[model samples]
Target: MTQSPAIPLPPPAERRRLREAQSLTQAQVAERVGVGRDTVRAWEAGRTTPRGRKAQTYASLLAAASATAHEVTLRQADPTAPLTPLTPAQAFDALYAFCAPALVRQAYLLTGRRELARESVERAFQLAWHRWPEVAVDPDPAGWVRATVYECALSPWHRFRARHRHPEAPPADPADRALLAVLLRLPPPYRRTLLLYDGVGLGLPETAAETEASTPATANRLLHAREAVAARLPDLADPALLSRRLAEVAAHERLRAARPPVVRAGSERRARNWTHAAIAFTVALIGATTFTLHTAPTQYNPPVAPGATVQGVPPRAAPGALSRAELDLRTKLQRAATNGPERLTPDAR
Candidate 1:
């Protein structure tokens, strides 16, 4: 006899969205799913996926959540409905609350640093809040934010940070520590691809789309990553088991995300600050340009010559016939030819 097909679970972000839409908390969902709260958190965050009977149970829960959310949405859409649509802030907050926790864990998996992971997710969300118009209209806002977080977390520039120059402490579990060490040894691209594909349970096409790589390239990276991991730990030969293990290594209990309200408030505050700074910079720039236009000389101007003493001029003699007159008379006497005294006297007159 042929077996029935398995139920397809929604993406991690969508799972969280459905649960949130129904106003269900992680603990509540865990109670219903017969799993620990942390396990539910891991599943929602994309750090891990449940398998076999548990997978079926989880899928069922998500399906019920989706149905409930749909009913609520339908009721709200009626013309005579009393419900109000979400405000921009409400939507932003909803997206943040739904995904930030999982993003933090995913980032921690990628970088193996709790602080950096938390910081990356916060910064990404703040940026999303800043560009709310674009993010709001996006087909997959969660994916947009996740991409931003990945970029920030995996940035090569982090190497230059003094604090990040040294490694943080390793995980408490020897297996987790060993797994993390091996994962870190893989090149960043391969590591990221592996996390998104194997760890996150994303299909090849979805993983490729998220990683911004071609299907062939993503597949190649995943294969190489698997080979590398298997070389060290042959027990994780199965892709499904590898994904689960990856999730555990990345989602340490120590990595806690900030409260949703805090993250939302911070994002709004950051956006306001950015707006204020841009305004200030623009005003300053205009003022600087205006000052330049007003104060700066318009045309070339040659410098004026300084005064100097006149050469070849005699000093003033006390008004004896005016000094120039006396000098002229002495010059005339020296030039006159020496004639008879009487003739000289008549001629001098």
Candidate 2:
């Protein structure tokens, strides 16, 4: 019988919990995941993202084992409550209700396109539904959904598609348009930092954690972001005033401010249909656009070492081709090689 591969590692914070739930040591996990123990340690410690097929298997194994243990614990804790697995429908409904509105607003703020924001948020929620088992148990499920939305908003294919569509609501006045234009003109990192900080009202540490930067580095980015915005739009220089203005702009521009409707219980087919539709649309778009996705590999060759020649390639000796310095160096090396034994004499030396 073929043994199934281990599941991929979950988020760094939850790795330990998942491991402990299965009563597995790091060594056991490493062996199962087909990685070194130190690799498992690095994953649990948040030093790196678990890469490759083993990562997916490791996460699957942990989530499956964790679900079983979780249900057992729940049953022990409460006799009346059923020990049912969390279904896709329930997870989708819960995450959508909790996160949809805020994520819509964040997407709008990021993209400056209202309809695009709605679509991005829904698409992210749909994806969350498909992977609910893994995502539902994440330490910050809402954050996970939000990150997915952010990815959708920033995707190049989506951006290209969005260029032809008009925004649902254009700015009513020139000032609003100017402010938004300047805000969007900032670099992506600075813009995201500003939105997470000023627009979403996340504190320094939370924003830092979300952006995967240290607190000090997040602060520096925020400061520079403020300075850049202030330099361009002098009225926005004041931190408090900027935050208030951002809130007001977002309020005015948000297409949907209401929470998503509850997905009925046992509507797994409905949820799957929604997710499948999104996937189909994305596929169609890719086909229509002839989009080619490029992935960077984990390893690449460095440039040729200094002073090393390619094998079988003779030095350039043509008069015009050789620079004076190059010619001098080559001539000196050739002379030294030719004169080696004879030049070893004391007088020659």
Candidate number of the best TM-score? 1
lDDT of 1 by residue, 139-176 (tens): 66766888899999999999999999999998999998
Worst window of 10 by summed lDDT in candidate 2:
1-10
* Cα lDDT of model 2 by residue, 180-266, tens digit: 888778777788888777765567887788788899998999999999889988988887677667656665653673343422322
Model 1 poorest 10 in a row by lDDT: 1-10
| Per-candidate TM-score against the hidden true structure | 0.65, 0.49
lDDT of the structure predicted as candidate 2: 0.68
Clashing pairs in 1: none
- Model 2 ranges off by over 4 Å: 1-91, 162-169, 257-349
Candidate with the greatest lDDT versus the true structure: 1
lDDT of 1: 0.77
